[model samples]
Target: MNLLRERLTTPGDPGALRAEEGERPQSHARAYQSLKMQVHQLLLSRIDLEAMENLSDDHLREELGLMVERLLAEENLVVNASERRNLVRDIQHEMLGLGPLEPLLADASVSDILVNGPQQVYVERRGRLERTDVSFVDDDHLMKIIDKIVSRVGRRVDESCPMADARLPDGSRVNVIIPPLALDGPVMSIRRFAAVPLTMANLIDFHTLTAEMAEVLSALARAEVNLLISGGTGSGKTTLLNILSGYIDHAERIVTIEDAAELQLQQPHVVRLETRPPNIEGRGEITQRALVRNALRMRPDRIILGEVRGAEALDMLQAMNTGHEGSMTTIHANSPRDALSRLENMLAMGGMNLPTKVARHQISSAIGVIIQANRLTDGRRKITSIQEITGMEGDVITLQEIFSFRQTGVAEDGRVQGYFQASGVRPRFQERLRSRGIHVADHLFDPGRRME
Candidate 1:
């Protein structure tokens, strides 16, 4: 222990240490990682786990900070105050949180964290991907962090499993794939949500949608119109779904089904159900389809599915058609028409064997609106199209455009230039909204009105 401490804290030229800027040299970084691991192991050896279980998170962090500072002082470490603080923080994170990910998770501006392997980490900030300097000591260190994350959520990943879907306590969605499947070492992606959920006003501020579109969507939610949000990955489908859910009646009983619970619905009377993966023995597996079927019996006024990806689509569609109006779910598709085709494919996956026409008819009847979200070439997420499912037209499901964002060109700065405009076709559901006393203005559907 003494030898390791001496090696880690050996004083270099005082001027050289003080002048260090930007990233540390490779040798210094390796030495720092070694020092952190030694301190982390020593701290684990000294702390009483049972006693720690009694401490609140804030208290535990404070106590750990003091202990780490004491250890550094005893070693006579020759690091600057900034380095000292970072070392203490890194040690604390190793003990109580996702080690190298703690800083990224704490950052409010980061929307996504992508870990390719031990040495490369990337983050999405403001819809742009940027590489980060954060990394793990090695593959083993990365695996430990992955284990900590999955174990907290009662999920597991290993050579046998090789994959897992989990979430942070803060509701950030986490996906993990390891070894045989990942090609590289364990790869994990975290889709982060805001500490405070984004509201419709926030979306409008971000130029994601217009105020008129927001009004129409709010009315759709209140009027119990089943909605399908279509988008590619990271195009803000879940965020928009959450904002729409805010418009749901507080008195109504809402049930949400998800593979992993990521929806932040703010209703007093709500039930959230998450699917369970098969255990090591390949028994006791619960799927979203089973949960959707079970949610039907709960007498929910509305059913909000996190995403429809498999056999669960049949049950979700049935729930919407029967009585659970205002139910919403998302799908991965580039356009509204493609979304319908995907829905049809998913219905087939359910093994109902309904003919093509019959399946199309079922979808046309159940879905009231399809809101297409897209991450444009310039990396801005916007609601590109909103189409109303206008029933069948001779074995085909017909759709009418209600509103859309037309991209004209990319600006010199590489920002996407677009205008959100109403398609001039007032929706058939406008009548339903009116019947429920939620009136949308006539001007909201006027084609002449364009918002940039």
Candidate 2:
């Protein structure tokens, strides 16, 4: 142990690691294993693990310092002054943070973190993105960080497998690419999750949704009105859909299908299923379409698809049109009209040769309401339009907007000032509600109503 401490603390024979013949560096696996085992045994021999548990914080830390010192000296790991400082840093990395960027990523206010390479790191704070000086020593360090992240999720990343998508324990999404695959270097992108998933009330407080809109949407959800929430990427469509699904009766069975399982519904009768990516051997791939088909057989009263982006849109539409009238799904689009068009396009991806008119008819009958959420230039997510599909007129599907947000202008503070106004187009679904003995507010279309 003393010899190891001396060797580690002393100046290493700088040339000892170099081979005589100019060949590849020999593996240090055997030496490293021996060093680790000797240090661990020395630590156990001197410190009573059970006794330390009764010590207070300060006392425990004091005892730990003594234990570490003994472990370091007895192992004979003589680290020179320069190496000693680095050893301290390595210990800090394991005990405290992921170098300097861990604290920044852990900050609740930080929305996104980007690592262009080993040295360049950027973060998105508030609505503005800024570059940070946080960096790693090199690609080796960066790859270690990537391994640390993926290892926690039972994922693997290495030379043979250069790319992986994983989530942290807190559900923060992580994507990593290494070596030749990443052109630049090891790259990582993390999208942090909300500490506590937001509810409808929380969205109202955040100004993401007006109270009146929340009330109407909640009522619509409870009334079993099949809804399609549309938005661009990061426009909070799934978040809003999650809160809307929260309105379903707790007694009814709910089945949710997701690609990555981001929804956090709290109902007791909810069943959540996530799609699986293909294994390295090109087997065991379970897609969202498969999950949607499986959910249909689960005897679910309501089926919720996290997003309809591919051929799965056909199954989602069929589910809603057949018997699951209370089902909900999301699509990527800029507006309600575009959402229907996007649905038609995705339905085409299913390889069905249905006529365009028949496709529109199927969509018009399947989707009852379209709530288009827009991320304004100011980074505020607002329900820009609420349109009801009033069936087809001849060969064209008729869409009537009941409520819309018209921007007056940008405020002095750069925030957008918009008013939720009624389009004066009476909801065609009003008669359907009346037929079902469901009464809606008479003044729902009145422009005088304050959405607040």
Candidate 3:
């Protein structure tokens, strides 16, 4: 008689013979027989926890593997090895990072991954794009994935804190939102960068910029000119800024401030600072403005802001005007003009009673150039405009188009082909260049020819 039947009847298998007679063939009689033998063998092979404590992890794993193999054999089960292996992997992956998305995250070609809840996943691959069939089981499963992501970065996420901004080990930017705040259940956005960060020469090889453009930007960097990179979201502003900042001499002391530090500038003397969000108790927040003000006292030769979004605009502009010549920052805008306007509006966010005209004048004086980037219809990123800040002409800040992208025509492959050409009018900065006894080459500003 089986122990289960005997236990149900009386203690110590009392009615053993009668129980054996009663237990006949049933619908799952074979399953029961198979399960009983495996359990008996498992109990025989069991090691005490105290004994296992002295075993190395590898030894324990090997013993567990042997146990599972013996169990499978005793059951006379012909398991599909690949599917069963995948099943175990999937379970572990779901407990960690939602199985399917993990592969894409590991892929170097993938720059961004968008998972619309659980059903849809899209990836930006190479210069082109495509979608993949990957999903989470449900909202709970998605939340687990988010927790896994943030936990690796030493961040927290819960109802009290339904949002988080963090970075993966590879410096991939991660943002997560959950529940009522998200409205569409849990959401995650990961912006990935190349393992070996792209340099100026790398960008040139990718057709993102010409060698001549790189040279000009390098010269601007060496000249300690304040540059404002303007672009819509994901136009590679920070990437360009990182490459540009590499041109700064390692001797100069550099300070960088960011909401989330993303810039990877390769310089010896660099101080990176990040803004802090309010704590769970709704206190102890260090804002970008505070960082910028504090950066001023650090005796930095140049200040590089990751991006200007709020009251920090006032401090940044003041810094640029007061002996910080090469201070750089980025802003979200469609064009150079809009970026300047956004700066003015963000200055107002400081809650100071400064007039719009005053802010415009400050921007016109502080900023030297605006480098505009745009994501084209064909998914190509190009520097569409480079406008020199020619100071304020009355109430309007004048911007002269130093270099512009004139679309020569579309290629046979449906990609737009264009080259950055200089406007006929020379830059006003030539006078400043002449003052430094550095001649501005006439051919550098020439039109209708490929200089690079």
Candidate 4:
């Protein structure tokens, strides 16, 4: 967990800094610095703060504001009301919230907050990365805020264990890497999440997928066909998984296992499990594989693995082949073929010692659909391919793309303009859907049909 609590801002350009900070230091930045120093000095004075520790933010802010007012008045210093209010808010955040990140966290458009040490901060907005001016006062201040967050999640980050993964109060994913492994300074990456998770309708509106493609996916999911989503990092696999999970019958018990518990499945019978990292002594660690095995004993109608990255692939594949036909998970792969290869490698990591062809056969039989997603250059995520796994043919898993997103052209604004096209190859596994009382129209597989 992140646990550094100091921030220091160093202006890179000395001339610009001198110009920004004129003779009398009249800049708002200067005023904030001066006020911050005053607040720190007063805090160090050991003022009676025992009563304020458990107070609500509003009450605490009111009390802190009054204390600041008294200090400024005694010092015979005068300032603008706006500057004083800003200073008070900053102090409140420093004392009660994440120092410089509070504003970015509150911004709905910001999707990620990357703190590279204390001096440089970056944010992801609209799927594009941009550097932000928001930064901490020094490294200690930044470490303090990091400590505040990771500690809440019962994690620790120090010289002994310099890496930690945690979640925020709002379910945002957090990754912290500190020295001596981090090299430069403590590095913190926070993947921000929306207050309300995205739904299928939202994906359609965002053009992540066409209505026709969404319809096909909903049908397949409701039909209890085992599916795998393949995508690169930040390619919207988790969002797509969350949406498809909605198609499961709410009456059926669903168990979700994740490293950070980011999936927002909206079923009444949902059981969420999160992996546990080992403690300070390097013991009592619970991995995703153990959780997957335990989930089987819980009588789950469907099992959702957030993202299979290791030995857990074997158990998840077994779960799909067994009674849990509708089980779903995501994998880091560029295409359906790569997904299978990745699964094969992961299955080997399970210590099963199965032959290569045997693992390939299991992969062919377990997964029914591979939904490949891509994050385009223009910050749009598209389902580039939807392939179905037919049975193995001569030590190979046969895959046929039933739908593909073909980029017709790029718009003048650099936005990608693509349409989903039917591949004309119908899945050979329609009998699986039929067995579950589901039907698909023949025209859905027409070669000339444009699914958009």
Question: Which candidate achieves the best lDDT against the true structure?
Answer: 1
Backbone N/Cα/C clashes per model: 0, 16, 0, 20
**Taking the tens digit of each residue's C-alpha lDDT, what string does model 3 give over 340-402?**
889889889988778767889999999999999888767777788889999887789999997
Q: What is the lDDT of candidate 3?
A: 0.75
lDDT of 4 by residue, 1-452 (tens): 11112222123422111223245456666556756755655554534556666677787767776666655565445678887787777777777788789999999999989999987899999988999988777767788888999899788888888898888998899999998887778899999889998888998988888777787899899998899999999899988998899999989999999998788878899999999888889999999999999999999999999999999999999988888988989999998889999999999899999988999988888899999999998998999999998888888888889889888888999888778888887777677678888787777777786655
| Sort order, lDDT high to low | 1, 4, 2, 3
Candidate 1 segments whose C-alpha is farther than 4 A from its true place: 1-26, 75-78
- lDDT (Cα) of model 2: 0.76
Score every model by TM-score: 0.93, 0.78, 0.80, 0.89
Off by over 4 Å in 2: 1-101, 151-163, 178-181, 430-440, 449-452
Q: Estimate, for each residue in 227-269, the C-alpha lDDT of model 2 and write its tens digit.
A: 9999997788888898899888899999998766677788999
- Each model's lDDT: 0.89, 0.76, 0.75, 0.84
Which has the better TM-score: candidate 2, or candidate 3? 3
Per-residue lDDT of model 1, residues 1-452, tens digit only: 11122233322432112224454446878878866776787667556677778888888888888877876665555677887888889988987899999999999999999999999999999888999999999999999999999998899999999999999999999999999998989899999989999999999999999999999999999999999999999999999999999999899999999998999989999999999999999999999999999999999999999999999999999988998899999999999999999999999999999999999999999999999999998888899999999999898899999999998888999988879999899789988988999878998899997898
Can you give the lDDT of residue 203 in candidate 1? 91
Ranking according to TM-score, highest score first: 1, 4, 3, 2
TM-score of 1: 0.93
